[model samples]
Target chain A: MKYSWYRLDNSAIMYQMVLTPRAQSLFRMGVKLKSPVVPSALKCAVDKAFLRHPFFKSELKRGFFRPYLDENKLPFIIEEDDGVLLKLLDFSSNNRYLLRVSYFGNRFFIDYFHGLCDGTGALEFLKTVAFYYFDALGIPFPDKNILTLSSSPSEEETEDAFTKYYRKPELGKGINSMAGGQAFHVRGKNFSSTGYGLIQANVSTSALLDAAHRLNCSVTVFLTALILASVAEAHVKGVPKHNLTAFVPINLRKRFPSKTLGNFTVFAKIIIPKDCPLDFESLVPVVKKLLEEQLGEREVILKLGFTSLMSKMPLFKFMPLFIKGFISRIGRTLSTPKQTFILSNMGKIDIGENEVIDEFLFNLNCNKKTPDNVGVLSYGDKTLISFTRKIVSTEIERIFCKKLASLCGEVKVISNFREECNAL
Target chain B: MRCKNCNVEIACKSSVCPLCHKPLVSDGEVPFPTPATKKILMGKFSLAYLVIAVIANIVCITLNFVLTPKILWCVPVLVSFIYVYYFVSVTVLAKRGFHKRILGQALILTAIFAAIKLAIGGNHWIFISWLPAVYLVSDLLMLIFIFKKKNEASKYIATLLLLCIFGAIPCISAYVFDLSVKLPSIIATSVSAAIFIICLIVCRKTIIHELKKVFNL
Candidate 1:
């Protein structure tokens, strides 16, 4: 009967495109990671309150997929329509849990689509949902472990007035205009984690960064270069061509808003230079530098410029599908420095475990299983690098882990990787 | 695309260094090509448009023939006109406002009818269908031009046009079928009202004009 924020519409954007069967399959596999049923009280509270939020209660509807597009330049709310809301509610009713989850059954997870939210926003919702469950259960919950920054010199959130009014309007278009010109990015073929095992190593945040610095690299570069070397050594061996790419998650918090958590993290790929020495020792330095440049704000600006221009061209209105495919293909062939796998290093997650129980468990539920090969690098009290590969061989993961381990000292390889497993 | 060492300047697509034969992306890439998305969507949308228009036209044709054989031809023309106009107007308005091609068609149709009406003078072929034609054309234009692309302005225009058409449908059908049909002026009004309601409902989050903006169109 009522939707809280819909009365005031802050525009939103939704991008839809087809994924390969492999991509679609990964999502289904992802659903298998149904954490335990969450705390009973917390679960009950969330279930009750979830019904109040329109996002959870909403369902997919049929229309020209255009209206839902928030071209107002910012995420604004829309006045909910009785008919549309009713239809969405009806659709969502069948799968309410899709929007909200009892994280880990014990953990909290909100599986929002990336185009709609970034890691910053995702983490915000994650913390909010956890507290919602706790308060609902009438349980004694401590302060939510969310980080908020006071106004500072080095710390900046995406306060871009331009993007605030800039709703990536082209994204709002109905799958129209997708590619053209040097859309600066390290092109990559997504490798799902369906059949891969995770290779993680826990290093003190200080130690981790120190090791990276010792290797003269950043956290992202060290991890990616190591993974690339592992992959090259374990799988690509003597092969002339190693279809290797590193899909790095670029956090937009600095340029975005402190509270903004949506899919603001643009995917910047760093393809290991094709002819480089495959040994882990040789690769780290090269990758360290690439990751730094790839995520630079200027790089994003340059890439966006080309993509924006392409979208504005009238001739490309009906050209996205063709363009995206052609680009992706060319990306495969000519895309050097291509993206092979993504290295998501959620740099040291320090929520001060001194107050938490049995230390904090931080695992990135990529919302859904990614079709792209991925290594989720998170360092809490423990550094766990979970690997997923539907497209590549798991041996690469082994070598990658070994390389990471070698950075500190040496890593011990463990196999028999399971899809639904999580190591802290 | 870039250098491996400094990575600052432009570089050639090769294995060795141009300025500093460092490497493109250490890992060798083949540059394989794949099919594109535009080809897929064009095929998909064109088919959707064709199917929807054909079915709608067929329904109109059947209804016209069954109700009144005398004004049957008008059914196809009017219905087809509506279908064609939808995407066309949406597309043209996206680039520029409605003009030229859109209005020219109306004038051509109007003149042909005027010539026919003068020659046969009012009574030939049951001229009542002409009333709906005038109502449809005038209303559609006003509805389209009033909105300045993606604002609430277009919705009202859309609402108005939809309502006008809702009213014209029944009357036009009756006239083309050559049947003596009596409908209150309120009928036209209520029809338009229903269309407005539907537009509000269907186009809720995804209005086309707004969509163009999101895709940078």
Candidate 2:
């Protein structure tokens, strides 16, 4: 490995020592292939791809003060535990691999502990694995433009983008917009089992495309509006006339030029003022405008820089880890009320041209603080919306899917719920 | 295939939902990916600890030999080394089946400590007196914890009972060994036994419930 280890980036510190069973900080990306996935071919693909991205294969170790990643001799092995998806990872135990690859039928999914990488980095790794899987299947060479084990990893891919892109903060420009009243949280009976409830709503991409086009907005904005509307109806009950913000993670790799497979993402809040009559029609324009404004290079840079600068401070860096962990836990708790829910869109996954992959889906664990999360991803002609929640109620998902179905005239909702609890 | 119960599209070769384990009828949908092997290349933290410990012991032995071969101070070094190994293995490495592991650890520690005392020309009282007293206290605490139920009032009652018997060993040892400094042990045991009697009266119902849960009546 070129680098022994990098310090846990500012973006990842919030999740490091304060992890609970309820908040494992895990997310998954699954690929559904056209043909029955060959186990040997998949294994070969992983083994080959592992060489190119050895950073993901490294194990996390508890250092004297902070945690560091140590290189492991064994590659991250794939498990066939289809019984429970996104299972809790105990980093201290024998299973030190930060990543897990699981297979069911023609579906292959990689569950990543977020400390390893963000959605963008995880997606990039999975795309490469898919590329080699197709190659192992003796499929015709699709496209030459793809990341493979042959390509030597660059220093840029392993660079700490947060530190690299961090500019000295201007005195007056340091702004903290994390001021908001408590949100109307979604409450329900928790699952008897610790596993999250998943509702995978597969919408025709063309239908969603048309809806976004009509709204003069992107799919992400359109979906955010629908979610807000659904949450308002199903969970919030009544408008509290306060700031109900939806925290969206913007992948810095999109705006900045860094390919490190660690956390290089920052959050931007899209606030839906409680004063407004919350409706899909009105919220679409607001969400679109908010995203456009926050997605700017200058604003994101400042926000991310502020975080990076704080971590770089000598006083903050010198503080004992236990104290830092305590402060981080408190910060997380205080910040929870500001965000109504977390929505992450990996946008679209493209392995290569003429690939046999039929679809892709993304989902996240329901954290202790934020009990609900919606992950969006698209593959080919299908858009997979994974509504992962910790509670027994799927009212928000049902409402959101029903709204999308109303627009598209068809929507397929699949869930991991055992009981026909929430009747459609 | 789709699960009728969960309504989740099962990408499984089996005709059942992995989540709910409900039967599924094939709608001719393809399954998800399959892995090459179920076997994992497991990481060995314990093995790493063992290797480091072995290397350190070798270094200590070499230093002892270089200093003075006749004295062989490496013997105590070896005992201390083994104690460190037992500490890590019992506390850090093992996660499951703690009941057995903990008892095994207690036995090993007692044996190691007794051997050290004997080697240093201490009296047999180290084994007969000190070791048994410590073991008795630890074993009682362990049993209380092992029997304690989640969010139970009986745990507090058990704590009270443990406190009552706290000085029983010191007082008994003093009387049996015919020690002159028996005043401290007598006072401690009297106070403890008195408090224990008070708790047995005050927390009678809670103690009964705890006993029932522990004995599975």
Candidate 3:
């Protein structure tokens, strides 16, 4: 049966692995940031990264992992715009992924969707470009954090795992409709300043992996436990319990060849109920078990089934109106899940300090679309625990930076969401 | 599908109109034409927004298990409906969304949630209840549009609030009225149904009539 559901095409598929979802605010970067904005050196680094690893140009092999535009047949594959995707907002801050550039007074929106690459992979690419850009600018780049997200040695080896699963969309009962609708939250500009704080920690990818192994959890879970602990501590002022949906995006790379430069990640969600008496230590075992089981072959099969259903033939192509409506109605419920926030660990992005590629990938920043309510996470030689929040006070970023410094060895907090580029 | 802004008569399959840089137009119909040359989000945003609202209501079932407020958290739950209304009002259906419609949608959802959570108050069985009621609201809204004015969905906005406020009311009233230790499902359903019928009739005779007379409908 055909439905007037969202369809995709080659453009959606072309830069598939390169697409990254941005927070809506991030999208407005082009319109937001005051311009006279020149392309930053970070952008040049991006040009260079593309030099090393030109995006893998593969045809649409199957339905699952191919870059597919959302219901809106937007041309660009999704990726973060460095203009808004900055480590620190500077004059020449045209920090963007290879394709998406939202600088100046516009949204830092990477005019792409989430069919190309996962947050982890995209961050790797972004950091690589930034590393090169910063080194050239005479800014001392951090240690060469070797890229940890490994590609399957060969496409043939991963074919079975990739092919075994089908797209399976798990959702509640049907609300059959198609078409992108807008329900933008009206933020209160008049929101009185309430003291909220942020802190970023740089836990090396290796150390995080170690913690994950010891805790019997994925690096995501271990880091989540830590974040949860921190939140528990920070909100100790009669901590009002809040239900948190930690949005976790997972790359659907097993079925297809490596989408080395596309947005090809799906949101794998975890719900943490507020006020639940979860001891920090106890959560590790449960999270470890969940991670171990979730990545199994069966899980992928289930996920693929949902993906297949979602990728149902476009209603306008051949299916009758009634059939199309029926199928598309089902598709909508099949796509969404409940979660409060997104915490994706783009595992590790490495940049060598070699003279040729002096500074490769430097610091990490959340997608412009990533809300301050949201947290963009990654771990390499150092962990990047960044938050995208609305600032009510100058001390919010200051407090978070201080807190992060205490959590790990040497940590720096780059305050781009607010006034100045002051690092304490 | 041609480009909306420019006279560029590109392929029905093209995303960018050859002459003008404009989004491809769907001509306000489903079964949008898609060719290899162009990419279109064949799905309608309004429809997706609608679907999200219904599923979101079902997700509210988590409230039964998790510690949370019933009403306030319900506000966040209404975000989907707000989006749906926004789409339908501005884009798909093309009309100014009314406060009553928003209120109605919210109330219907809240009541569905309130009823379901109450049914399986403790046991895991409660989550199932929200789904059926959510389905009912969406289905009934669609069906009602057939009988009432152009958009009957708005007509029942008041009733929806009544449902949320008085959802448990019948039960409470039954207990208060000394109707019975256990009020019959038929009775509660019958009473609500009666009120709804009465409300629809009154609407047709009054506000709707006024709308027609006032706007020469």
> Best DockQ goes to which candidate?
2
| DockQ, ranked from best to worst | 2, 1, 3
CAPRI docking class of candidate 1: incorrect
Candidate 2 lDDT by residue in tens digits, A192-233: 444566777888888899999988889999999999888888
Runs in model 1 deviating more than 4 A are A1-40, A43-91, A94-98, A103-105, A135-210, A237-243, A255-259, A295-297, A304-338, A354-372, A375-379, A391-393, A402-424, B1-167, B180-217
- Candidate 3 lDDT tens digits, B86-117: 54565445332343453345355556545544
Best-matching candidate per lDDT? 2
TM-score: model 3 vs. ground truth: 0.40
* TM-score per model over all chains: 0.51, 0.69, 0.40
lDDT tens digits by residue: candidate 1, A89-112 = 111232322232422322233334
Judge candidate 1 at residue A39 and give its lDDT: 50
In Å, what is the interface RMSD of model 3?
A: 26.4
CA RMSD, predictions in order? 15.4, 17.9, 23.7
What is the per-candidate TM-score for chain B? 0.30, 0.45, 0.23
- Count of backbone clashes for each model? 88, 8, 104
CA shift of A133, model 3, Å: 7.6
